[model samples]
Target: MSTSASQQADLDPASFRAIADLAYRESGLTLVQEKSSMIQSRLRHRLRDLGLADFAAYCSLVQSDAGQGERRNLISALTTNVSHFFRESHHFDVLRAELDRHLPKLRAGGQLRIWSAGCSNGQEALSAAMTLLDHVPDVARLDLRILATDIDPEVVQFARKATYPERLVRGISPDMLKKYFDQTTEAGHEPSYIAKPVLTDVIRVNELNLLSPWPMRKRFDIIFCRNVVIYFDQRTQEKLWPSFLNALAPDGVLLLGHSERIAEPERYGFTCTGPTTYRPCHALKSTARPEKQKQSEG
Candidate 1:
């Protein structure tokens, strides 16, 4: 084959289309032609790991009925996992306030749940745990837990390990880092930190696809779905709004990435309570306007 033909065959147009369709069907992720080169680069390792020479064969395997298992790995490779401790610091502030508000009910034997939806590598959930501790040092005694979930099983496993190298944890303050992380490094390796039981003890990690049906019967007090839905197309995103709204307690808050917005959240039973933050207003499914930010009830 000519060099151009070989290059085309490597990530053939058909293969690209197949990969994109498979990703959307399996995980509600959107792919466009402009990103084909980047997708090709990302999946090249998968091809090699599977002992394949090019995208065509890899695509064939992943798109077939027998390709069911590989679909997970394919989505894992395609998904982005950039995250840090206490990203979008304001959300942590909101968490502090919410935890404080719920302290009374929690002390009275009520449960408080927070979910780090699309939680990548555990930082977001850990950060929430830290925030909860900061707000109420005795929080572990209460029925409180942070569910950290991601579609990528590998990343979920990484989160469950609760270990982080220096670079991935840059957002953590020195004092909090010292208090919450144990230096778990060996003599020859670069310095790394593992979340102490004080943090991890309150967190549960699981692999979950946001597009799939959620198994939790209990609604959450806070849902941090930041920087996640941006990967989906408008229809996919809109479909997610109702699920998130239903998953949240009536007065519960939902936070999104700075760039992500539910096109008029009130339409989907949420009121913009803060910057890219929302609270369920289920009563307003039809004619409710965005209400003024209401404080969480104590």
Candidate 2:
């Protein structure tokens, strides 16, 4: 009564929905119903690679402790990391304004720290650096830095290399294009944009998974978790919001995707501003009065 390869390929809709739910819980992303075909297509490759003809057997492999590598592969396959330089323009604009507004007031020992929680490539982080360098004076002397991270090892490596197809440079400003990048041909054919010295001022890319406990104990002045959160389910979003709040400094600001907003910022001590930005509410220090402490003495 074992299912055939074709039978397994035709796994019931329920199974697909279950996989989607698991993915949402694990990665904070949703696989739309239309993506069943996409799931089947991609998982089929994993099935073949694992030598499992049936989807049930593949699912079993993914669930088993011995199959942890396969599970990661499944996650990598499902998560889409399509990001570009200045993909959402207003956010960067806000970043520039914030830098202009905050740079001079920062304490001597305090540095400007920003996190691009799901930075796919290095573009967003680089863009942030460029903004700071352009707007803030002596940015290098200011102890400013960006921590950019992504779940995918492939993209992380790409970010490390900091190379991209020449066509990807369309949106980059001409002045920045010339100042920060070197245009060169690699392997004697394709054009590549390589990072120059200016980029050294801005970003440090890391391999990070947002759903997992953050390795960073310190807080960031600003965190950009845009577009990425929308993929997560409401429950996961609820859990993540508090973690993000905790990761922010007393006056830290969080910039979320334009389409996303916290349902209850007051619960997390986050006060909403505009559509999708949040600031940590500064807690007033309370000192107990002697009279109040002795209220029952009378």
Worst 10 residues of 1 by lDDT: 289-298
User: lDDT of each model, Cα atoms only?
Assistant: 0.86, 0.75
Best by TM-score: 1
Cand. 2 Cα-lDDT: 0.75
RMSD of every candidate to native, in Å, equals: 4.5, 8.4
Steric collisions counted per model: 0, 1
**For residues 1-298, could you state the per-residue lDDT of candidate 2 as single tens digits?**
2234543575457768767766776677788888788788767767766667666776776667887787678888887777888777767766776676566665365588899988887777877877777776477676687899988777788888888887777778889888878988878668988877667556888888898889987789889998888877788788888899899877677888767878877787776654466777562222111111111110
Off by over 4 Å in 2: 1-18, 105-109, 283-298
Q: Among these predicted structures, which one has the highest lDDT?
A: 1
- Candidate 1 residue 1 C-alpha distance from true site, Å: 16
lDDT of 2 at 178: 84
